[model samples]
Target: MVVLKLQSAQFFTAPCEIRSRKRGNGQKFSRIIRCGIAEASGEPAPLGQKTKYNDGPFEKVFMTLFAKKMEKYANSKEQTKKIGWWDFLYDYERFVDASKRVMQGKNRMQQQLVVREVLLSMLPPGAPAQFRKLFPPTKWACEFNASITVPFFQWLVGPSEVVEVEVNGIKQRSGVHIKKCRYLENSGCVGMCVNMCKIPTQDFFTNEFGLPLTMNPNFEDMSCEMIYGQVPPPFEEDPVSKQPCYKDICSMSNPSSSLCPKLLA
Candidate 1:
């Protein structure tokens, strides 16, 4: 008989077991016991256990659009059809790889411009005008926008909820608190998050859509906050732009430099 044990100090719970038995006709029977508490409570699994991500129709639509944009930007001949969770991650990593190649000689502003253009391409025709008309720069508009963002952006940023935040001395539910940013966690590239996602998204909303916005990403926990109707600071003044590489976690990290090399590229 073989027995496997997995214990975690954080989750002090009884061990769940899996048993296999040999039957009379030389056949084998297996019984699997899922962790009931975690499953029922909607909590993450215990330590050392791997979690599988699932994709929905909404996620697939966005992934397809993003992949198409990246494919065009990189001038690749390949077409991406499968937008499953894992496949989407692979495609995102490939886009990052292409960013390095295509943005090698570009300056910081130019790199941001490239990403911003890609973002614009993904949107529908006159989306900015429609968005501006729908959601003006007001507390009620921002709060409604924030509430709807959770469902729309869940695939890219993982689970998130609308949170009340103080903006200009007024409290409003115009903030989205991401439990963990899947883009940051999966890519592990601070530059990619900043240049490819953070800057472009903020600029897209603030400039194109005529709505002020900001994104605060915490590298330590891979969490993030999206605040609508809040003006984002310039790149030179933003602390995120000055953040150094995650040498320990990122595979493409440059330890010798103080900042991520991809920031300029």
Candidate 2:
């Protein structure tokens, strides 16, 4: 058996202000703002272990079953290559089809067992039994904030090797700075612009299950530039007076040509 271990440390923080779109009333707008600091350190275990199985006939049965299901989708050589052996077994389509069969009073538990067997057949050869423990479901949530003084190395010149990456307002300790850019022309947005962004998760779910579902924006409806800044003003918004907040900055019609002044230096 081969084992590998890894460890790393990192720090990040951001201050965010969320503004809600105004209702019909003329009252002043109320908003919630959050600021916080976050840091973490951890060591990671090696990826996976090897094991052996004695059930040869059962393995062949699962391989045949999964291949039959994949035949419908595997048209070209490129498609076959893209659908790896493991995916042929548990691809979302198979899951939904089996679910429907179960709901229709077919061999429910037995069909599920077939799916599990197919997955087991796809595991890398000699994988350890303990590998099953690694498949447990998990969830995560986090928040952060912070500020800083200066470092000693700013004095050095002549093509500095260090790279700085900043996200939201927090900068990374090292590596080339990566700034988010707008997806659409004339839109001062980065990462993802709600109007232009297309997430594949919803399509994957809908296509496999024949269900119509759309993943919508979670926050208030606002221009992308407000959430993620970009180089020049991408596009113009409607007039300020007509908008929920009657301030110049709130208007989408008039976009400022000024680049982020901080980046200029």
Candidate 3:
């Protein structure tokens, strides 16, 4: 088993504010303004052994399941490269690398589609058919979002929070700040970040829930903001959509840009 190198410091993200389109009126999440603790109410599953990072075993199982599902959904050439539960111990971001690898050789568009599809496939049995909807269930959106999505997000990926932001002199929290994004930082592909994670996630939430969302991923620091109740901008108007690969420094970089299907003719 690989010992995880994930440090508590790597988990720290200076929550940044995104210019929100609308000031939220809901105060249901006031207690979680700056910190979100993903408490699972399910019968406590086995977490296996404790890691030096204090990560339990259950999350490892979750990651393995998600990773395997992603690999299965993508049907990439590297089928043998399935991610292991122990990998989370080596580093929480290892799953990101595993995700990118599965989608390797596919275009940004296909990658996006595959991941969105995977999200649905990974849903628990008897999960709502919300993924097939045009908008979130207008009724009880906040309740369901808090009960289901927030905890699942923390389990499936990482701890997320909502920081207080003053909008027009009103201190209201309107979004989730992911201190570390497993998808963006490891993909190392600007187009992948845009198409796979940024665009699809926004569309998925807004369509599945009545609440509109806008996800802004800051490449330099691997931090991201998901503003709820805010409509996302079009492809042309979004800055991350126009970003280029990390000039020769990206893990997936190559001499020819042709490999990046977003630029493909």
Candidate 1 residue spans exceeding 4 A from truth: 1-51, 75-107
Tell me the lDDT of model 2 at 194.
25
Worst 10 residues of 3 by lDDT: 42-51
Counted clashes in each candidate structure: 0, 13, 7
Q: After superposition, how far is residue 23 of candidate 3 from its true place, in Å?
A: 54
RMSD of 3: 14.3
TM-score versus the correct structure, for each prediction: 0.73, 0.17, 0.61
Model 2, 1-265: lDDT tens digits are 1111111001111212345666558576776532111112111111121111111222224434644543333322223232224543432233223323322222323333333444445566544233223321111000000001011111110011223333346554322111211111112221112221322222322232222223222112221111111111212321221222212322222234332221111
Q: Which candidate's TM-score is highest?
A: 1
Best by lDDT: 1
lDDT, each prediction = 0.68, 0.25, 0.53
lDDT, residue 75, candidate 1:
41
| Candidate 1 residue pairs that clash | none
Task: State candidate 3's TM-score.
Answer: 0.61
